[model samples]
Target chain A: MQRALTLAALALAIAFPMAAVPLDLDFYIGFASRVMIYAIAATSLNLILGYGGMVSFGHAAFFGTGAYVVAIAMTHGIDSLWVSWPLAMLVSGIVALGIGAISLRTRGVYFIMITLAFAQMMFFVFIGLKAYGGEEGLNMPHRSVIGLGLNLKNDATFYYVVLTVLVATLYLLRRLIDARFGRVVEAIRENEARMETIGFSTYRYKLTCFVIAGMVCGLAGALIANQTRYVNPNLMHWIVSGDMMIMIILGGLGYRFGGVLGAIVMLVLDEAISPYTTYSKIVIGFVLLAVVLFAPRGLAGLFDRKRVRAGGGHG
Target chain B: MNSATRMTEPVLEVRALCKRFGGLVATDQVSLDVRPGEVHALIGPNGAGKTTLVHQLSGTLPPDSGSILFRGDDVTHLAANARVLRGLVRSYQITSIFRQHSVLDNVALAVQARSGSSFRFWRPVRDESALFDEARAVLARVGLADRADVLAANLAHGEQRQLEVGLAVATRPAMLLLDEPMAGMGPEESERLIPLIDGLRKDVSILLIEHDMDAVFRLADRISVLVSGRVIATGTPDDIRANADVKRAYLGDELEAASGGEA
Candidate 1:
């Protein structure tokens, strides 16, 4: 019964963009694409924070870098996404490797602070690069062409592309969460010292998780750059990182659709409430507090009927 | 498995190990060796630095000065996980199994540690029948096969202790450092664990740090008594029973009480 509901939801997501195109609901379509991009970013953060137990506060470093990578490549006449998108992922991955190597050595709050420091450092580095428009931000010449005969310039087409990416990302992440790697990562979260005594080099596993999250978030950054046609140092700001964290918590930490649900709700609330009130944040804050006080597991956790049992499936 | 060939040399050798915390000496010039296929028991009173010595041996705590040789390789500098990979595994005095995991998963993780690289990111671990099969075999060995699907935290204290030993044993250790595996157990629970350790002697050598004199005498091939962070005596059970130094330092009336209770 739940499976049918989930499939129906997916079907709605696919058909909604097509229906919105004819109904002149272009603004909603663009908003939906933005939500998907945020969903990808939040889900990537979940891999490290929720699963691996690494509370990184500098995820924006990767997200901004991915956006910058695409914008910079387009300025250099690299208009094909085939080259720019992978470049964004690769660059973010390498950056994550370097940051993770240093940051993973410290645990708990120190880990969080160190990651934040690295991200702020990246933010400043980009700000210093006057050639890339510095604090003013850079504008893309045009959205990178897919060359597959689809018009990325169309809002509906871009929404479909983002939905496809989100679905693929979710599928791959699900596989990863159920795999041996995920089990080890989760075990490390439960008891790291035990993992070491059990012969696991836990540092390496954590570093890998950090890199994967960074790479995926980078993909989101690339899509967002295409969607907005703008890249800015503010994308790497600590506020962005905090926002992504909020989305994960709002959706439900460790659940597969936690990030996606959180992104949709958060974005929808912002869109609907901001027009009427300047205190929209205060309203959202109360909602978040209520969720924490009542639900404790976020929005996605509400659908779970049975209490988690021993040897049960994980998200 | 080839216990005969390795019997000529000590499987583990600790030399002049010392650890000092400021003015206090926790472990002073401690030294011991466990021969292949033998269960060497280290007995001591409270604050005798038995746990400190175990920490140093297992690479959790670095001894201020010591040389530890495992399988003839100097592993004093190796990390805990490195030592584990070399088949030097330890169970905690305070039962440290993964509390959130299932009883089967707790052992399966240990088996997975020893089997292959945990960097495998594609296939689900549930689909790995061989890993689960080996884990079940380990659970059966530790007498937890019936409770394999139960959450580890839900187990009774005695059963959790069994799972603790089960975790170490599943790692396929060459030498097991069991730090009071039967701690906080009733007499009946302790009675059940005696044969479990006894059964492991065929394939694995054991360095047991236990306070239970009955368990020590029954399981140990040789006994070393530690008092005031020093080895007072090292000999066979009967030999140590006769040693006056062992009597005065740690045992005193405890051995008599153990024998009396056993009878």
Candidate 2:
């Protein structure tokens, strides 16, 4: 069921290929790419929080780590996309391991608070870097190139790269969620005590999941840095974590495709509402409040009974 | 089917087991032995500490005192999960299970745990044919093969109890702890359950705790009666039923019929 959903989403992505001639099409395509990136990050959280029953509030550390990797590598007279991309992923994975080792010891609300503290510490360090544009941020002199055949600076080329990577990630993540490891995580979510009696060291499983989530979030961070062509301490702020949570909530926390739909809806609303009034933050806050209060399960619950419709099946 | 063919070495031996809760002594100096493929029943009234002994044997709770030997190794302070690896699986009395998971997934998870390296991420266990075969076989054993895809939360209470035992059996443990598995069941449910449990004794050593005296006497080849944190008697069902102290502690008037008394 999850596989079919990923394939359908992939088909939609390929058939609509966003880099074509229509100017407005480019805007929607760009909107979708951003949405896909957020969905990727949010989905990683769902893997741990929703499935593994872990609630982490400091995921921005991995995000920032990824961004820093790309930014730092690019500024050092190196514009090699091939090198920086994987390097960024590896760095994020390491950061996740370091943070997860300590933070996973704390359970429930304590886990959230500890994760938040780690993220803040990292954010403050980034802000303190006087050479790397400090608190303001840094503009990339050039986009990283894979050399030989690829010209990444072209908006069309980069958009498709982001799109392709997003689809592949969704495929891998969907498979991971349905696997035996995924079952254990979900089982842990359902009943850790019962799991223990059956002979599973739940802590090992949780840490493994925590690292996977962090590594994936790191990949999303790299994509975001590319889209903006900039890096800043703001990327690692707790508010960003809050934004990811909001996206997941609006989509319905555990609804697979609903998470993607939520990111699209939120970004589109932000864009639309900002034009009507300058107080977009206030409007976004009100919209979020309404979604939480009136739509407890978010937009997906609006179609609670209408599950398995024509739009997509088994997502 | 016979106890003589069971493990030549005892699967578990409790040496002076004791569990204390501040002012209360839950399980006091209880020593017992369970051999593989044999049925050893632990029977007592409510608060006789049968459940406490089960907890300590399963390693969910470390004994406040005394060592537990399983398969010739001392597993006194081992974690609940570690004992499970050594083939000591236990089912809860409360019918606890992962309700949100499909019946297949629940059993598959236990299979995965027993399969070793439950952290394997590259391949899906559901795709593994061996896992499917094992889950189906265990579910079939509990007479739940038809409901493999059903959500456990939606199952009837008795069906849930069956699945609970089915889950323990899936792990292929050397010894099984069935803790008051028939509690709150109607007569028909009990009729179905006894055969399910009886079938299990053929494969594994079972230590069953039950409040139902009839079921205890019927299933247990050897019965141990516990009272006020101590084992008052350890003998065959006929011997336990005839003991004067065991009569006063539990069964009371019911003991007379089991003893074949004229009164």
In terms of DockQ, which candidate is strongest? 1
How close to the true structure is residue B218 of candidate 1, measured as C-alpha lDDT?
Answer: 91
Task: Provide the lowest-lDDT 10-residue window in model 1 chain A.
Answer: A306-315
Model 2 root mean square deviation, Cα atoms: 4.5
Tens-place lDDT per residue, model 1, B163-247, is: 9999999999999999999999999999889999999999999999998888999999999999889998999999998998888
CA lDDT for candidate 2: 0.81
After superposition, the stretches of candidate 2 with alpha carbons farther than 4 Å from their true spots are A1-21, A24-32, A278-282, A285-315, B1-6, B120-126, B253-263
List TM-scores of chain B, every candidate. 0.96, 0.92
Report the interface RMSD that candidate 2 achieves against the true structure, in angstroms. 5.9
Q: Deviation in angstroms for A249 in model 1?
A: 0.8
- Error in Å for residue B118 of model 2: 3.9
On lDDT, the candidate that comes out on top is 1
Clashes per candidate (backbone, < 3 Å)? 0, 1
